[model samples]
Target: SILSIGWAQWILSDLPQDSLSLAMTHPEMDWPTAHAACPVLALAGDETLAGCVPARRRRQLRRARQAASRCGRIALLSASGSPQTFLDQLIRLHNMRWAEQGGGVLANAAVEQFHRLSLPLLDAHGLVRCWLFAIDGGTVGAYYGFHHRGRAYAYLGGFDPAYAEESPGAILIGHAIAEAIREDAREFDFLRGQEAYKYGWGAVDRWTMRRVWTRS
Candidate 1:
């Protein structure tokens, strides 16, 4: 199964005890569990990114900025145009990075279609926050997220590996966090991952549980 392929955990913590009744109603169906770990950055009142991150990370961000600056100018563009215009570039950059990393959800047709349709609606409601990073007039990275109820969720992001030494992705994320702080967002959620990099950004672990119900 795809879940197995992805090494997902099968949790039965919330499954109903009366399995016999469930079997009578629906038979031969197998259930799978969904797993996720959300890494969150709690923002203090009017805190800046420099204030939120550790001193070491602050230094790293500073150095990254310096390295990237030599290429010309590093610009962070967000919600500056129609969602339609941004989606194509966003997906293209995302796919480019994912392709280099083996593969990702963006490679899936359904997921691609979902973003293509959902971004417009999210943008219309001002819930969507999309950002692109450009160096010397060349697009290098993109981030798509949602801001709602005083929280900013970092949904997805991608950067060209060709600029890996410059760390454009990290630079873009730092700017996004700074923007969220300026907007007075209470939390910046790096949704659905326990990746090591999230911790470097001063994120704390918030685990999400899942349950699978099976008929016997």
Candidate 2:
């Protein structure tokens, strides 16, 4: 059965189930499948941000910091008091970066609407956290994600291409991980990506699977 296959491959790979039965039936339909590699940084027992990465990455982060500092004042702002005010800026900064690269999730109307409507609710529940990296009073980078069940997930982010050479994106990520550690999160999850930068933070690969069901 499709359900059994999904359970075996994703939910619980070690579980044994020889015979499975399906009580419902439906017509077959085409379904799409998606795949992603999630990178995760495990935090345990008073580990400092610098301690979580390798020596080479630490040097890179140091260089990024110096470069960002030279551009102007670099600040990491979070969505704590007035989240609404930051949401607009976050979207704008994200679009600025992705727009030049062609497009991104925010380019879709439905996805943008979902984020607008959900941000407040998630904020109220303390599940969502957003960060903006500003330079000399201008927003240049943004990080939006959720913290749940002791895990801090890096859901989405963007940085001004103008600062690409300055490495604002990498700097922001470094700050995010530091903040997560301060908040006592057990793990920092780079939700879905095989991006090389994620590995610099000492993140490990975790496979994700998608399940599709069609009745025959």
Candidate 3:
């Protein structure tokens, strides 16, 4: 007999009663493991997008935007034709900050190549989105994410550390969240991680479980 295993599978909805009963009745054949939490921001509220987050975060974002503006005009640019250019920018900007720290998620050639090959297909499906943050006409940050099935997933981001005081990443996220609202997404998912910044945006955790099946 062979066994199948799944890890950290996102549980977006309740399981059928029959499925639960099966798992309980045949622990050896099927069972659940520890759960992982993902931070998600509800976008279905009646409040405006600006009001979706906490007051403190709003104030902080204001200050950061003002600070960054002082350097130059800030712009959030979206990829229209070929998203590859924006993806490259993301990799460069991300590496500028994470390289010294032993490289970021996009640092490896394999990872970069994977995105290069997959983005076009995803973009064709209208699921891929990339936003570049620029100050004084120079790009300082980039956000890579996806919108699907009424949810916007904040997948990855990279920023110029030189603009640390300006909070380019945070500012870009604010704009991205607004875009998500315009798209009528029901939730803005942070995907995975317990990063403190996610909570600042009033994100709540949703749990997912690992399910395993084995032949007896």
Candidate 4:
């Protein structure tokens, strides 16, 4: 048996007939079993950061910025070279944010190890995009994602929920979206979620699927 996950789109139609037999024992069940909706924000080549969001969201963003500013001097820093510091901060904040919900996606040591091993390689190839949001030298938020081939994929992020009123997560994401546009990414993919906030940022649903295969 074999299983493949996180395919951005269906490929059953493109598969060779011979391979299809080996790929899935029950195509219909396998196709929809692990499918999920992903939100993606399409970017026009010539849009201001403000233009990426709808009018209502733009107002919310403005208020978030103002609230965050009142906390301290706000700063958004891009990660380069070794990103251990950013990773550490992100994990801490992420865990803290989701602690009440059991834990975060990166709460496992093995998962942390995966990022440690892979981020450098991705960074070297200019695919890794990470940012840390700080207030008065203290990190409050982190955005860890990838950008490649005109698509910026927002993989994961964490922010200090203590400042939820300031919308730190939203602010970090908004900045990342603007940065993606600056880098000429045609799409900002908020991967695998139907979260209401994703739609607030003018993102639309794009589905992804996972499939498993068993020997006949």
Q: Can you tell me which runs of candidate 1 are displaced by over 4 Å? A: 1-35, 45-47, 211-216
lDDT of 1 at 183: 87
Q: Which has the greatest lDDT?
A: 3
- Model 3 TM-score, 2 decimals: 0.85
In the order shown, what is each candidate's alpha-carbon RMSD? Answer: 7.3, 6.6, 4.5, 5.9
Better of 1 and 3 by TM-score: 3
Scored by TM-score, the top model is 3
Q: How many steric overlaps does candidate 2 have?
A: 0
Instruction: Report the C-alpha lDDT of model 4 over 21-139, residue by residue, as the tens digit.
Output: 33454533344233578788888644456656787887888899999999999998998776787789989999999999999989998999998888888899999889988898998
What lDDT would each prediction earn against the true structure? 0.76, 0.73, 0.81, 0.80
> What tens-digit string does per-residue lDDT give for candidate 1 at 93-199?
88888896777668788988997898888888889888888999888888888889889998888888788888888887888888888888888999876899889
Q: Which residue pairs clash within candidate 2?
A: none
Candidate 2 regions exceeding 4 Å error are: 1-35, 45-48, 210-216
lDDT of 3 by residue, 1-216 (tens): 113554433232333223453354544434554457788998854334565878798889889999999999999898745778988899999999897899998889999999999898888889977899999899999998999988999999999999999999998888888888888888899987889999999999876555554444
Q: Native-vs-model 1 lDDT? A: 0.76
Give one digit per residue, the lDDT tens place, for model 2 in 128-172. 778888899888888887888888988888888888888777877
Q: lDDT score, residue 97, model 3?
A: 82
TM-score of each: 0.79, 0.78, 0.85, 0.81
Off by over 4 Å in 3: 1-27, 44-48, 214-216
